[model samples]
Target: MIQDMGLELIRIMGPFDANLLGRLLLTLVLSGLVGLERSGHERASGFRPHILVGIGACLVTMAGAYGFAELSSERDALRVASYVVSGIGFMGAGAILRHGTTVRGLTTAATLWGCAGIGITVAVGLGWLAIAGTLLFLFTLTVLEWFERRLNFGGPISRLRIHLRDDSRSVGKALDALVRLGVPVKRATVLPGAGTSALLDVELARTLSAEQAPLLARQLLTLKKYVVQVETAITPLDEPTTMDESDEVQKDDTIVPLNLKDATLLRDLNDPDEAVPGSQTERSR
Candidate 1:
């Protein structure tokens, strides 16, 4: 009975059976390796999703090549493989995002598409080719990233949008503050703001790191009586919004009252104990 069972096990685990299992395993490993790298960088799509995509593609390709082996020669065995290619394109498109003029997640999308191809290659019995492709992908993502940083190639750029009190002197104060912070301004534009505020659009020549950005914003806020609000992002500036001449006339009238109120508030806060024009305190002083 033991000898008979051994023979049956060998029959079931033959070369054909082993090859199918090997292809599936290889697809999982190669795709998982790519996903691991992406996960380390905290990308949108990481290990498990990539592994699933790869394994699914591999299964689809295997089904195309072997599941229909008994079909007539007139039937197309490779039709399913073609569908896999087309379907994966939509997945790639979903990974991309656009912000104003800048687009992100492009590399992640390309990596996902490559993972699918690796799976298909393994399923088609091109195991060696799949291995080589995975290695190349890792090299581009890791070694090439190091190279780019060393050479300072394509460093990140940022945009700063600032809203300030609409006084003419505020613009000069804001500019002086940025200069003291050592941020090189590539472009600066002033726009009309609501009531007694003016918008300033600034593009920096050098990129600021995540840690440095908050520090810079804090410094700008302390420019004392000049800055109202500050916003920053790792994206390029778009075209400035245009204002009408008639709108400027209305704004001037509305802004004067608001400015007077703000100035009075600042004065009282700065010198709370000082007497006003006709107070009893003023008469005593």
Candidate 2:
């Protein structure tokens, strides 16, 4: 049975050597194009992974179509292709990520799946479909983003850097504060900081005009336990991190709101039991 199966496979696959090689090369090109756009945007899994997925899927599809084609009339030759579709999900899931309740990389994950589809399409001799699918993927990644921005759908995206205690609770509170302010968090990360502190880096969308950043900063400082020191300054969205120390503190432009000493002083001056309430405190009832 084994010898006959080998013979059947050899006989069936013998004529498609040159065509198979051509399909692989075509699959490589189509998938590579999709990956190129993703890499240009600095996505998680870029060029090489995409090409690998596309080529791998193509090979699996080929095996499903030809490797089992001559085994028996009862064999389902396309079974492996179906598995490819379902299995691609694991790879796609790796591309998806969660950043402070804002899920990112959904598009990247979808692209990986699309690349697999491109591979399978080419493997099955559906070259036109593969090419068309690739073009559509590229167009969605490139053009759809521009339309999203132009529509004011996300307003303006701004980056905020908060250096605070390394405790996870503090980080959560800071993010919660941003959310309460009504700007949706587009992305967030906790980076290592000096000593016991961590940097809470966040990207916010639909932020108010740049002029209001100080008021916003002063406001965040109210989270005394969560935020150690706070200052708010607004520069063009493209220039979020470019401010120098001198510029960040200049009272004319930035608002270096209540530092720890000031918070303490207010508590000292006001009735000690009052808890210094207009740079306000949220008391649990």
Candidate 3:
């Protein structure tokens, strides 16, 4: 072997070698950030699930690239990676939940699916691209919500705590009523009750007309067949705490954001929170 030092160096640097461990570690950090954002929002799937999806995709890609390298002259790593993309659809679907016309957890599912892509990028040795993608994901999750609120681009959001009888048609009837009022539901959560009742929380970007909420409460009350208690609150788009909603949600000690003070309408329709002067309020029963 008569090889010049420069030529030998070129051969060592060029043969499509991937730093497997380094890529995996980079992917781990990237995926963790995405998961952390989702967890902050109390998503159904977060942290561990995203990390698993990313690491798994990375491993699959690496296996495709190297597993068949010695066994055959032709190798197609991208084909293996394609399966990961398509197969991840099923996992993403698990994160979505539907209740009546209101759907929740779609954003969570989307992020999980995104993490899979990040993993593949890292495995392909594009660490920089993967890092960029994770940053974008975080920005969308954290900043976009604030941006939407700041611009007032979306309508105000409100939460309705509806109590219904145990009968199955209860939810359907309530949804029908809301639709008649031209209200579009964004999210609905139902919790089983102790006796012949269940609790449903309706929230969203759907705009409510003047006196519409009070009208809704009264109209739903007419459905004595199933409707029980209906309480609506104007939910504020406050900055989420580092902890999840299960923990105490703390706001800045300085002053209550006007929207947060609006939430008091749910409890005290007679007297608005004195702390927040001129705070807007919506009423429901």
Candidate 4:
């Protein structure tokens, strides 16, 4: 009869523990914010995945805290929390991406890891600490977004690959012309092409604004020694091959005046055997 009474008392109080209910509510709230940010940003691990991770992290944290609290002997909650850290790492790794020279999704993965830490903190009854962490994460993602744009510091950098005919003379002339123009050339690689074709890999400076590039490109077209091709920083092997493409591609807009002497000299260089015309009017349009 005494044993039955003890068991009934345990059952009655078991479902109403203040610490247990608090942990459940705290973890749910914290994880929800983390998941919300990911979903809003359109990540693959957004919505359901993040929510699950947050809840799971919270449970793990609760387990570590409660297990330690229940022990009569010495127990380290931190030891159990360390396992959560390692487990979160595996999830973070799945979010990173690599494409040629650019690596993306690092911030998103870091955010996921951060959510786990916050969840653990909440489970350990560090309510204030968890709230502060959530605010910091949102500030970094939202406020810093505008700050970066104002400085024009973030986003993908432009990469241009300039291709020319394989002839050494043609390439040399174009290089000389570019050098004369003071265009910041980052790198130039010679790539073998089919037949007598070849590619000149070019990296340019951001100082060359999109608006200003068209004017300089008009002069490049007037040069007779070589044709050009343009591409972004990463050029896929299967990309279509083309001639006379430049990083500064121009739409057929207003025409520029061509100096007759420059035009005659260019014509002579391209076709030395033929008689050159005096008027530059042929290329002016």
* Candidate 1 displacement at residue 175 in angstroms: 17
Q: On residues 150-215, what C-alpha lDDT tens digit does candidate 4 reach at each position?
A: 454433233445556666776666555555555555445567766787766655433344433453
Better of 2 and 3 by TM-score: 2
Top TM-score hit: 2
Q: Is candidate 1 or candidate 3 better by TM-score?
A: 3
Model 4 misplaced stretches (Cα beyond 4 Å): 1-15, 68-72, 154-208, 211-285
Q: Write the per-residue lDDT of candidate 2 for residues 109-216, one digit (tens) a residue.
A: 898898988999999999998899998888888898777655656355556777676566778778766665554667887888889898787766555455456445
Candidate 3 vs candidate 4: the TM-score winner is 3
Native-vs-model 1 lDDT?
Answer: 0.72
Error of 3 at 186 (Å): 0.9
- Higher-ranked by TM-score: 2 or 4: 2
List, residue by residue over 1-285, the lDDT tens digit for candidate 1. 999988899766533678889999999999999999999977778898789989999999887787664565543436776888889889989988764333657888988999989988999899999999999999999999778554544465566877787677777677766664567676566788889789888777666654455445655655557777777775443332222212221112232211221222233222334578899888887
Model 2 sits at a Cα RMSD from the real structure of: 8.1
Q: Give the residue spans of candidate 2 off by over 4 A.
A: 1-16, 73-78, 165-170, 180-182, 191-198, 210-212, 223-285
Provide the overall lDDT of each model, using Cα atoms, as 2-decimal numbers: 0.72, 0.72, 0.72, 0.62
Models 1 onward score TM values of 0.53, 0.68, 0.68, 0.54
lDDT measured at residue 187 in model 2 versus the true structure, 0 to 100: 82
Alpha-carbon deviation at 278 in model 4, angstroms: 51
